[model samples]
Target: MRRGRDEQGQVSLLIIGFAGVIAMVIAVVVDASAAYLQRSGLDTLADGAALHGADLGATGEDVYTGGLPEERLALTEPAVRAAVGDYLRRVGAHRSYPGLTFTVAVDGAESVTVRISAPLDLPLRFPGSPADTTVSATGSAVSTVD
Candidate 1:
């Protein structure tokens, strides 16, 4: 009779443990999904900035040329950087992602590259798990006018 009574409450403990495990799994899934979405957003922003930079034509160029001139289509480092900065500012990317950092550079004579990075805070805390994770993405665009 005492053994049966002891076993009756044991199931409750087992149920509680199982519930804890399930909760932890759910937390992990939610946090992971959030991080993935944040990364995707950063990637999209970088791609847009890079494409905008690549589309900027060189200054003081003659559009009357029968064929596309290399000088007009060239991607300069200063021009690429300026275009990328302007785009980021216009879109308020820094305001959207606080503590975000980015870099813009000319990948080649006709290509622009942009890299953006931000930190994501996890929704749940766990033993030995980082409180925040760094997410970064790089995008490149090539000028086709040449």
Candidate 2:
């Protein structure tokens, strides 16, 4: 009879334990969503930078082939660098996250290729796990020949 009376309290204790587990699950969900949004933003920034670089590359190629005005070639690299730099600065400043960096690379002549990499930090991982992510975008364009 004594043991049966103590058993009544076990149900409430089990419910309380289950509630704590639910709360932790919700926290993990929120952290994962935040990390995903940040990564998407970084990817957009990379895409913009790559497009700008590709435009510059195309202009340079056109100049070499006498397809575009000579002045356009002269202005190409500086303008592209400016645009990419500005984009990086804008995106970086907008985020309050830590450990973010953008790397840019431009290549190709007639067909120009621009590559941008933006590093991000992910959240809500298993215990003792590293959370780092990189979002990359590339844009390519070919110069029109005269």
Best by TM-score: 1
Deviation from native of the Cα of residue 80 in model 1, angstroms? 1.0
Kindly provide the TM-score of model 1 when superposed on the true structure, using C-alpha atoms.
0.82
Local lDDT at 30 for model 2: 72
Candidate 2's C-alpha runs over 4 A off are 1-5, 57-83, 90-99, 107-146
Compose the digit string of candidate 2's lDDT tens values, residues 18-47.
Answer: 997887787678766765786666556556
Query: What is candidate 2's local distance difference test score?
Result: 0.55
RMSD of 1: 3.5
Task: Give, for candidate 1, the lowest lDDT window spanning 10 residues.
Answer: 57-66
lDDT of each: 0.80, 0.55
How much RMSD separates candidate 2 from the native structure?
5.4
Question: Clash pairs of candidate 1?
Answer: none
lDDT of 1 by residue, 7-88 (tens): 5678899999999999888889988898899999999999999998888634314334444664536667777788888898
Per-model TM values vs. the true structure: 0.82, 0.57
